[model samples]
Target: MNIALSNTSDKPIYQQLFERISAQILKGELENGYCLPPIRQAAQELSISVITVKKAWEELERCGLIHTITGKGCFVAELSSDRKLQIRDEMISKQMLLDTSYYKSFGLTLDDVIAMLKKVY
Candidate 1:
């Protein structure tokens, strides 16, 4: 697993971690049953607090994105394609709504948003 923390961003480190891992799972970058490093090990590797990593892992579990086994560590959950797509759309749509609200506050039109999205997408 790979994650980059942004200390300057409004998002917490754990939230960033959760989003990255969630994206990987939904995109099939992380396959079902793929085991993740232990929280302590992942924290050491990322130079983040163990608590932060633990919270992220917990959030992944809360979202049904990962499953934990006693003593075995966390693994990506097995999911049907339809279920994966459902979660993916739900997460993406929620974030998109938050972003669109910001843009709307700035009086940006849908065309303006499309133009901006086009630049990166």
Candidate 2:
């Protein structure tokens, strides 16, 4: 599992971790049963607190993207293609809602947003 952490980001470290891992799982980049490093090890490697990595792992488990087995480790959850698509859409929809609200606050209409998105995308 690969992740990049940004100290300057507005989001908390754990949130950044959770989002990146979720995206990878949803994209099938992390296959089912993929083992995740222990929280302490991940924290040491990332130079972050173990608590941060633990929180992110907990979030992933809460989202049904991973499962933890006592004495073993955490692993990516097996999901059908349709389920993956569903989760991906749900995640994107949540982010889009926030983005749309931000654009609306800037007085950007749907067309303006779409045009900008087209260019950037």
Task: Encode model 2's per-residue lDDT on 1-121: one tens digit a residue.
Answer: 7899999999999999999999999988999999999999999999999999999999999889999999999999999989889888988999899989999999999999999999999
Leading candidate by TM-score? 2
**Model 1, stretches more than 4 Å misplaced?**
none
- Which candidate number would show the highest lDDT if scored against the true structure? 1
- What digit string (tens of lDDT, one per residue) describes model 1 on residues 27-112? 99999999999999999999999999999999999989999999898999999989999999999999999999999999999999
Candidate 2 lDDT trough over 10 residues, lowest sum = 83-92
For every model shown, what is its TM-score relative to the native structure? 0.92, 0.96
lDDT of 1: 0.95
lDDT of each: 0.95, 0.94
Alpha carbon deviation, residue 69, candidate 1 (Å): 0.7
